[model samples]
Target: MNTLFMHCRPGFEGEVCSEISDHAARLNVAGYAKAKPQSACAEFICHEPEGPQRLMRELRFAELIFPRQWARGEFVPLPESDRIGVLLEHLSNLPTCSSVWLEVLDTNDGKELSTFCRKFEVPLRKALIKAGKLQEDGNGPRLLLTFKSGREVFVGLADADNSAMWPMGIPRLKFPREAPSRSTLKLEEAWHHFIPRDQWDARLNGDMTGVDLGAAPGGWTYQLVRRGMLVTAIDNGPMAESLMDTGLVQHLMADGFTFKPKQTVDWMVCDIVEKPARNAALLETWLGEGLCREAVVNLKLPMKQRYAEVRRLLDRIADGFKARGVKVSIGCKQLYHDREEVTCHLRRLDMKPRPSH
Candidate 1:
């Protein structure tokens, strides 16, 4: 296949296109991206036949901010009389896949295809297994059947390790009824996206401490409290009484930008409404000063050139840390629960003392 198909939030197709095009150029892959406004997806068509495979091999999906999920392949036209037969014939020429995901876009039209996709999955799975094209070999790629319409589908393959674990790159998280605000899902999803689940027990345990900026109503703080972490909720507004009742939170009336922890904390999370650059600088100060071992902060995007703005802010953070001789692992994502903002995770790796002149 010569195309890389990507699924993103509707209205963000332009960002996805911009991002993929930049990556392709950096990797020396000759390609151009195409996206329709609010289509909820984009495609990168490569000049070379092997361009898609090369990009897939070199690109790190976790580092990509806009695309929720992506696959590499070409669109296939299906006959109404025997769609499964046509797909099976095409599959026979490809390698065995570990699993199959029948997907649709995240738009209304895509929603309409959900029932058809669900009904088509079982029969497709059976047919693939019978044809020896689908097997759980642990190392095989995932088969992605993305339906654009009843007669058109993109037959793609995605490396399980390099793609989003969830279908369409969206995690289904239910909002807690007790959460003071629905914004709680943002932090919950951030953890799922940034922190590896295998390390959660050790790194995100009850013994750890956290700080939540803009903590009024305790949406973000609630996540820390529920995880059994003692938290200092910093804000000039009232926090949720339910959170205070947990005895896990200490509310402080102060400005998030000026507040500093009494001691180094395990985590610092912020969801404050502020300029993207200002928020990033705040995160830099906390990390550069060794105030927190890890942090999850939200950066509200501007009305235009959001991709460029995000890149500039992130680069500024990296440069700031480098100048301070601090090593950190950073990751950013436009999470499912986020709107006009992206969440960033920064983990302190280690620090090297500067040599005296």
Candidate 2:
């Protein structure tokens, strides 16, 4: 009950630990994180018995950039002969779970356990239901059983509204065959992660216009084009011929960092290869100057202090917007399709005039 378990990219365990430590300290929940490099998971053990419970109530999972999914619980050993029996015995103490997710780490060893988890799920689910510990109440908490091995698993609970919708926080997306490059998934995932589905028709409608910096081959531009938006593709390199055939694109050869549009557009997206701080600055300039109403950008991370750098860059952007007397909503995440980088979504809100000084 005093531990929080988190799932992340295989090599990003350190980043998760750093982020959790910072967040926990901010909430005055004295705790320490334990993680192994490349383990794909981390745990924060609270000094006080009730610390994790308080964190689960106050911490917003979507605000955490590194951890894909999180749960509050402790590990329990199971006898190989009666794994389900042991789990049922322990689950008797928990509230009725709405559903159960049997998860594994995203690693080679984790992959090897997938078949076992699948086979174990059917029977375990039935057992839980028969024992009256599982129900279909939509408001009930989700049971998270993360299997570390055949003999050990982490039993935990996650609030559906506060946690990722997908198991292990990994969305299952198949690459569209018509897409020019696999990179298209990055933008797609960003939209899913940042924008609510109900608001898409209003915010990402067909009547909108967009600009894609470094739009070579149109990997990112493809998303906008398919959604029926007119796009200005800026890149010195060539764009995909298929995207050009759409008759909705205006391709330009120019420097993404220096190019300025004649008029503000509805959206601006950048996936340029550049330093993290530099990319953050570019996004700030766009939103601050009223260049675009909304933006999606990827910041390539450095090898060290990745979490610290992300926070600094985001804070800088927020401070810049405040100085300019503009209101904006910012969201950042290390998307499933992203590697060594994080995706950011910035949306300009209605301007609130500053009071007389």
Candidate 3:
């Protein structure tokens, strides 16, 4: 496993890379993490011969992208003067591995693009015709377009330079100036890595429910409700009237930590203004008590070792679940909507939780 193509959540390159580096150190895998400028994909290229196969076997990917395992492959072109076969031979020994995706981060003249397409069997003329990126002369793939969603588009390779990796359109320190709606929710644009509606809808089921702590403005709640499950909104403040109007949510005017539902819900979600450890503890408590089936919460982080803090919280949460005989899945990402906090999604042991009065 010389090179593994890791797809991190959009805008979470640093967190994913740091976690991988830490895992490598602990497991003694010889590798370093590098960001791919084109998107949230990170390249985990191993220097040691056996590192790829070993790491992939032991790899426990984050839960957000769970069930969707990391695809194992390597970069074909390198250093502007390397042979693709030389690199491929070095990568060949990994078990049950096949195929490589040409990860072109940048392109110069038409020659380079054409060469890459030829090497990858990308069918330049056909792809261009299908994508409408070429002329009758078959010489252009130029389209300077901006997608708020995370779709994969073939821009003129030249146009890829200086692009933001996460593609959030642009970073904003504040919420939107206008009110949000289904139109504003933009599921396609927001979670572009996910498959389209059919698969996405299948992911949603009545078996799962959620709580939205500090769910005032209601953007997060909106996402949950659209899934057709009830959400308990815990906050002293009020939610957007629009969310309350949905009838899929229950507004509870109490502190999130103290407000236990009449029955354990399937999920607990929070975005409260609190320290990371404090939020982590709340998550642990709910998870440990079998109070919920899963959770998607946010922890507001301070400057200085934000990465280290994430490491600490991940350990704390994982340890807590293990002690409780819970098999859990967890993921964290600095979402496009996240400013100084990271979003976490955790699913507790799939076994039914203990009955609550």
Candidate 4:
């Protein structure tokens, strides 16, 4: 595998390319990136003979802001009649895979190929099993087969622990019918992405306290309340009657940025539509001042220099906490449910603020 492929949100290829280019340079590997904006895909053409393996080993998928899913593999143009045979040849080149995911780009043409991919999967799985390329015992890497079209595909592999939890980094979580709005999915996705699943129940215990800044209509608040948290919903606008009816939420008519909690809470969640820098500072303040143990906030992005802007804001937050002698865990992700925004999660490890970067 000589070329690296990544799947990002449409219109974000430039940011994706910039991120990979910087990352590759940091790894002391040279590569050139090419991307078609809004195509939802990008390619990193590596100059080194062994760069792909090293890149895969060095870069942790969770830390990448732009790419939803990525793979390092060569493109194989399948001949019409011998498509299966050609794919088998590629599979033989890779280590045995525990499972296979036949994916396509998030584009109109990609949607059109889904039916064909579904049909192709069954026979391909059988062939792989017969050829000793697929393992049923979950001891091998997972194969990622991203189809650019019916005639072309990128064959790649990723370790389960270091890769996205879902195929193409898109989680298939259904919107709860009882939830107030579809925006609820964004918060749910953020928790899944930033927090390990095994710690969820323990982390979000019953009667945990949380404050939802800009909590009008209660999308994020709904998620916290569902976890049995008592919520202080701050917003100038009215909250949903359904949410208020639950009695778990206290709708405070106040501004998110100006309001400060009278007491420390377990979590502070914000979905305020504001500039990324302001939101980033808000998160830094909350963690720095010992106001909350954990926080999840949304940073709506700008049209240009999106990736650079995100990196700057994140750095400021880290530097501010370091200056304040704080120990914290921070994570950022662009979720499937988010539009023009990225979600950030911060957890303060020190009960009382102490300096440690």
Candidate 2 residue pairs in backbone clash: none
Query: What lDDT tens digits, residue by residue, belong to model 2 across residues 55-93?
Result: 889888998899999999989998969888888889878
Estimate, for each residue in 1-357, the C-alpha lDDT of model 3 and write its tens digit.
266545444445565567667777888988898874435556567888567556655754323221112434443333344332333344334221111123322213322443554453344334434533334443321222111122222121211212223322222233333434332232223333222346444445544577777776676677677667778878787678877888888887888778777677776777678889999999888877877876777788767666788768988999988888878876665544456677776766566553332
Q: What is the lDDT, from 0 to 100, of the residue 319 in candidate 3?
A: 91
Per-model RMSD to reference = 3.6, 3.6, 10.1, 3.0
Q: Which lDDT values do the candidates have, in the order given? A: 0.92, 0.91, 0.55, 0.88
N/CA/C clash count, model 2: 0
Worst 10 residues of 4 by lDDT: 348-357
> Model 3 — which ten-residue stretch has the worst lDDT?
153-162
- lDDT score, residue 37, model 3? 42
Off by over 4 Å in 3: 1-17, 31-45, 60-122, 125-203, 206-209, 324-327, 333-339, 353-357
TM-score of each: 0.97, 0.97, 0.59, 0.96
**Regions of candidate 4 where Cα sits further than 4 Å from its true position:** 352-357
Tens-place lDDT digits, model 4, residues 21-99 = 9999998888899998689999889998578778889988998888899877888898877788999987776788898
Q: Candidate 1: where are CA atoms >4 Å away? A: 351-357
With a 3 Å backbone cut-off (N, CA, C), the pairs that clash in candidate 1 are: none
